[model samples]
Target chain A: MADKKTKNVFKKGAISSDFIGTSIAKHQSKTTIGAHNIFLGQVRADVIDNKTVAAIEYTAYEDMANEKFHAIREATFKKFDLTCMHIYHSLGTVKAGEICLFVFASSPKRKIVFKAIEYIVEAIKADVPVFGKEIFEDETHQWKVNK
Target chain B: MTINVKYFGLIAEITTCEKERILFTKKNVSEFLELLYLKYPSLKNKDFQVAQNQELVSQDALISGHELALLPPFAGG
Candidate 1:
């Protein structure tokens, strides 16, 4: 995505497989992009003290998170010869084994997309102010922190 | 100045409100945080970063924005 316009990367609930498929299909007209890399963040069913996580409810400082996403998009463009990029993150409740985050990057060369995708995802994990509450099977919840 | 302070994640759980308007006559972020600690004592023990006008600011940074946010650790993917 171009940095000239700020795009709201947050999506409600889990990002559907259909949406992701549609996004990939949309780029067919952009013939310049030869390589594409994607990163999908899935919620794990981690057991802590015998309680298993069932889902994650997300929240964010929307205005700031959008700003960080925009910065990351701009930085990725500056660092790589990327043709386009799209980032979508889930908000509200996302169940286990569901998709919560999707980062897609495209470039002319395979190597550029590989490095660009990782860079965008890592920056998102560190810079964005999006919060997650891990809800257990028993309904108890705990705040999640990036390790 | 009246600042609109917002709390997120566990920090909001402590404040029990997402956002509020406070009549703050503080000099810096630390001073403003002291006021918040007095109002919500549990917030003193929590870890967070202050954002002035949607940008992260240091504790020593002066209170210059009408909008402020208390953000906890990022778990975003």
Candidate 2:
């Protein structure tokens, strides 16, 4: 069994394009990986009740969140044939239009990668104990809920 | 026995603290929740779930783990 100890999936803030680029560039050496699908979750400036969101402050039960991520990763591996996977989420404040979550999956075939990406993302949304407080431009806030 | 209860999100706002340690007996989670509601009546109407040792648990489940958390709905991507 793979060590199931929690793996930290959180970065301190918004995921940078440079970091994502570097991640993809490093995978070039893995010639066996024929398909790589990526999911990037960007924060949206949602307007509600005449308030426009400016940013989001995210928090999580860190220990539990990491454990859940590990479990999800293992489940994805068991359900699909894949070469590698990477998941990342942001902690603290992330502005609207910034990337907050990133999931990357690689496999030998295109079909597996496509299905695996959606599965992994939905699992993260429902299972992880992360919370987001959306801050509006006027300093009001609201808790976010996944649909 | 004494257990540590951690609160998150709006629950923390109601409790005015992130965590607290309290004395408890060996019983089902529902009973423990009753005690919590007595202490923080505002929590009685709040929507949340219980996690024992980092696992989502039912109210009928036994309370064994030292770490217990009150979690609100998740909103992650």
Candidate 3:
């Protein structure tokens, strides 16, 4: 359980281009800060044992994923002093070499934004309850759950 | 008693189905897992976690005739 005083700032489900763009625009303010660091995680077509990955299909236990995402968001805010932060992860099918996650953090200083971005990305990858299915070029598929 | 159990990731592959109803006398999550491991010996070394009613729980948590989901660690961007 998280502390009641913390605020939840994450949105679950497949993130669309519009949502990503809008979140950035909304978080941009004159009084906020001077620097914003963004981390975009794009899927890659990796050759695994002579087989190239074609696409990745993502699935989630919705209720649990949402809870976990909220917890992560709150924890991130507590760990860093930032104006705002946003995390979006793809939920359905994402092709190789396409964007899968977009993380944005803004702060008054450039140094803080850089450190916050790194921390957020690491936490999301290590804690969130999201799964990916890797499809090979030949159409063979493999589920990729985090280690 | 029979309880519904759900599987995810590699565990799903071994069970060949994502969900099932198993009849067992186990009273806690750990005992249930021990029974499952006996039935599916291949799951001995696989990494997984348990959740009851969508809330993550420790292996020693008490669970009886409740909906539970087994999830492998997440691998998403």
Candidate 4:
């Protein structure tokens, strides 16, 4: 069935503030949620070899990445008291200081949302197979590695 | 066997293609990797993990199914 493919978490470019705001607004109808914690991963202007980073071009092994996202989502729900969760990542180019990842977790209480967001973000950094190519201001590039 | 191999990110840059159907004579992971290194010598110097049917497998394990992937270090946020 269609559900077997898992929900695609990738967006075409940088995640706009408008889209994020709209997502939050849509949750107003669900009166059960009392707290929401969001983590936005912004691209840093990293300076390497005296060159400053201008942007990052991202790519992934789509099939495997999707599966991993699904697993992470499932695990987060199992371990936390979450009412809902949503994650979005950028594909293609995202400029320095732009948002590339957005993780939103909501719960009935503030404490649970805080813990849930951190866990999900850390799991994503360590487990997902997404690659980032850092493009320098001079147009040269190098691969990005999370520490 | 005709093994379907997929390369992502930096690995794909070296291989010059995203996917290929390689004519593999070997059955185990090490032999298959050796054969790949023969075809693309630069790949031997790169860092990656091998996935068999979407699961990471050790070099000593046997290759199963038709699909395999070369995944570089994860840089996801």
| Residues forming the 10-long window of minimal summed lDDT in candidate 4 chain A | A1-10
lDDT of 1 by residue, A1-147 (tens): 454479999999999999999999999998988999999999999999999999999999999999999999888888889889999999999999999999999988999999998899999999999999999999999999998
Model 1 interface CAPRI class: high
Off by over 4 Å in 4: A1-5
Assess each model's interface with DockQ, reporting 2 decimals per model: 0.95, 0.88, 0.64, 0.85
Among incorrect, acceptable, medium and high, the docking class of model 2 is high
For each candidate, what TM-score against the reference?
A: 0.98, 0.96, 0.81, 0.96
Query: Which pairs of residues collide in candidate 4?
Result: none
What lDDT score is found at residue A92 in candidate 1? 99
Model 3 agreement with the true structure over A73-116: per-residue lDDT tens digits: 77777887787776677777788777788888877789888988
Put down candidate 3 lDDT per residue, B6-74, tens digits, no spaces: 887667888788899988787889898889988898887888888888887899898854688888878
* Top-scoring candidate (DockQ): 1
Model 2 C-alpha lDDT per residue in residues A65-139, reported as the tens digit of each score: 999999999999999999989999999999999999999999989999999999999999999999999999999
Deviation of model 4 at A104, angstroms:
0.4
iRMS of each prediction in angstroms? 0.4, 0.5, 1.7, 0.8
Candidate 3 clash pair list: A146-B74
lDDT string for model 2 (B1-77, tens) is 99999999888888999999989985989999999998899999988989999999999999999999999999898
Clashes of 4: 0
lDDT value, candidate 4, whole model: 0.91
- Return the TM-scores of chain A for each candidate in numbered order: 0.98, 0.96, 0.82, 0.96
lDDT (Cα, tens digit) per residue for candidate 1, span B1-77: 99999999999999999999999997999999999999999999899999999999999999988999999999998
Candidate 1 whole-model C-alpha lDDT, 0 to 1: 0.94
